[model samples]
Target: MSQPKHATPEQARPFLEAFKFFYQINDASANFFMRNTYPISIKKGTMLHKAGDICNHIYFITKGAVRGYVNDNGKEKITWISVENEMVTSIYSYYMQQPSLENMDAIEDCEILSMSHEKLNELYNLEPSVNILVRRILEKYYADAEVRALTSRFSDADTKYEFFLNTYSHLANRIPLTYIASFLGINLETLSRVRAKKRSIKKS
Candidate 1:
């Protein structure tokens, strides 16, 4: 996640729409916990968090995509991508109560609902059902992270790329070539060559 957090200009609409239903937030919980909920929109390539910044909010993407990445010597590497109907956060920093070392960013123009860290925790503590919802959401992130780790170890770059394309087809057309290369653990040049090869075969 990035350092020095800043709030977006508007509330995220699509996110809140889907999320309100996904979590099944009844009138009681909605009135009590998320009364201030609203929409926030971010353009592509916007940094959600910078290195060394504390994560104070959880972003639920209702539209577009989000990714977590790290930068070293001007080179950016993508570690995770969260898309529509998914939750995105700077995990280590948010839970550890420290500054983040990585960065979270938007890959496409996005609508995300930002929920305060403290407020969410308070709701979880007070409501048992809400607590379960929060736990399930966290579990999703954990499981996805594990899948990515396993894929990195057991698959080759081309296989990984193909898997990513087939599985997250919604993302295939929206992402940039550089980020896709980074996600597949292949150099951009290599990815370019592969794309060219595919084009050549299609033409033939």
Candidate 2:
């Protein structure tokens, strides 16, 4: 089970650092933002949000990893993976207040800062700097998404695995190969062969 509790400054450090990087705000505004958010600890395999559920909050991963995936005729297709210092949520569902088509799950035991949709809107209205930080974050994710779209469509299995290594090499050994294969839009055998081929190249 995921427990949502008041977050201490230590637990909120990642969010604070990210926020300060883009928009430096005073203690008062920062405090207000802190008060509205909470920390949650979830074990691996926990489903943070499920398809058909309205995603009520956006999460900032402080530890571990999560993946956004969808059921495609009983098959699970990974849409994206997020690790620490990154934000994860069903974007359209959170922004439009609609049921999500994607499901978010923890791939490893995770600690995350969560802010409800209501509180997020309040912050947007009251704190102009929040908008600046969010805009910058969104712009970054948008660019990454564009790269992912192009790579998934045009790249070969080797190129895709190489791109995944460049982008998420840190997670390569941390998470399951099955999840990585799904995210890369390749099968397990192909990923295994690619790994073996890469290993041989490195050795030779």
Q: Name the 10 consecutive residues with the lowest summed lDDT in model 2.
A: 2-11
Give Cα distance to truth, residue 161, candidate 1, Å: 1.4
Candidate 1 lDDT over residue span 125-177, tens digit each:
66667776667677767887887776566356667766776666676777888
Best by lDDT: 2
Give the TM-score of each candidate: 0.81, 0.93
Q: RMSD per prediction, one decimal?
A: 4.8, 2.2
How many residue-pair clashes does candidate 2 contain? 0
Candidate 2 residue-wise lDDT at 135: 90
lDDT of 2: 0.88
The digit string of per-residue lDDT tens for model 2 on 1-204 reads 855566788777778888776678778678876788898899999999999999999999999999999999999999999999989999999999999999999998999899999998898788777788789888888998987786588458999988888877788888799998998899999999999999999999
